[model samples]
Target: MSRWLLCLILVLGLTGCQSSAATNPKLPYAAWYLGFLAPNYMEVWLERADISDINGLIFPRAMGGVVAMGQPESLSATARGWPKRIGSGKGRSMTGLDLPYVVSLRWQSMVEPQTYHAAFLIPDWARRKMVESLPADCPVSGRTSDYRKDLTIGLAPGGVVKVWIMGPCLDPIEVLTLQAEIEPKGPYGGKSGGKYRPLSPVVKAYVDKYGVPYGSWWAPIPYTTVGP
Candidate 1:
């Protein structure tokens, strides 16, 4: 063999060799996520697989959440104000294979405590506890009654991650990842937020029909343009 051919042979021998196993290419599994919705806020609140202690994050006794499934594409579509068939509305549930992967959705939106007219209905003890958690200058609490905030947390193999909710107001589409604590403590449950009461008749209908979990009754968006 020529000097060039001998050098080529040596180079090939030093490196492991591999080739395509089949003529047809196989597609990878698409990354579909459990699209957790933040009730009336109409946003992709977060995404995750079921981890223990997640209930507190989703169904905090003080607030509620709803669940759905989506692709990265779907979340992008939602930000543009044109959510596809999967986006949910008040009293509606969107079902798909991903339904089983969802942990849950929080029921309260930043506006819920205020919009539900829940201030007067809160038990005195719960109200007092909320007041004590804030600064003396920040006397009021409950939903975003006098303030607005968004929280973000993430999880990885060895640890959890977070993007502290900054700003008094956040975009509805802001995404966060957080640790799951088997359950949430008494944090959110605006009056009629459904922490203690039966699901609204309309919310129950969706649950019964789809067998999907939902938090509160005030979905402000429709699942489809034609309506669900």
Candidate 2:
């Protein structure tokens, strides 16, 4: 059995092992990550069965590498430390804004740790709002996409944004699904405006108890910071 199958089996067994009364509420992003990783296993099995158009299978593993390593506590620690690393100039510049943003890191493959991609995504409306809200001294600037690597967006702080490190998958359905699940929700329970909130309590508890440990800083396409 392949590693993916083993993982699935393990998950299934754990689910079965628990009492029915022990059920826990699910996390939105956790489902998204599972969706992202499922296709890779499906593709692997299909390939072994001599199926065609197995390209879709590749993205799950690539994306799984990211989800596997994106532990919330670790990420929170990273966020807390970033202000210091960026130094007084950039750190103060970033902290002055009132918006919330996302940071994502993507690794090239499960094995290769030092290669990855990073990006920042801010909506145009958010940028305008930020400019209007903040003082003139802390104006935001956009970064151009080189295509080869690197993507940056500038905006006024305090709007919803998503930052992801994705593989070179021609089809991004899985990626889109995952994004939708994790994207912020508004105050009235819509899309997140601009902030990082913990996943639903059930989901948070699940991750705290069962999710894999995340500790990679050298992934290819690694380390993305998106915000106000």
Instruction: Please give the TM-score that candidate 2 achieves against the real structure.
Output: 0.17
Query: Local error of candidate 1 at 160, Å?
Result: 14
lDDT of 1 by residue, 55-147 (tens): 111111212243332224222222222232223211211111111111222322221111111100112332222222222233344334321
Worst 10 residues of 1 by lDDT: 113-122
Top candidate, metric TM-score: 1
> What is the TM-score of each predicted model, taking all chains together?
0.21, 0.17
Question: 1-228, model 2: which lDDT tens digit per residue?
Answer: 235644543444343322322323232111111111111101100001000011111111112221211224333432111112110010111111122222232322221111222222224433233223222221233322111111111110111112221212111111111111121232212433432333445335533454423232112122333223
- How well does candidate 2 score on lDDT at residue 13? 37
Point out where model 1 deviates above 4 Å.
1-37, 40-175, 184-195, 213-228
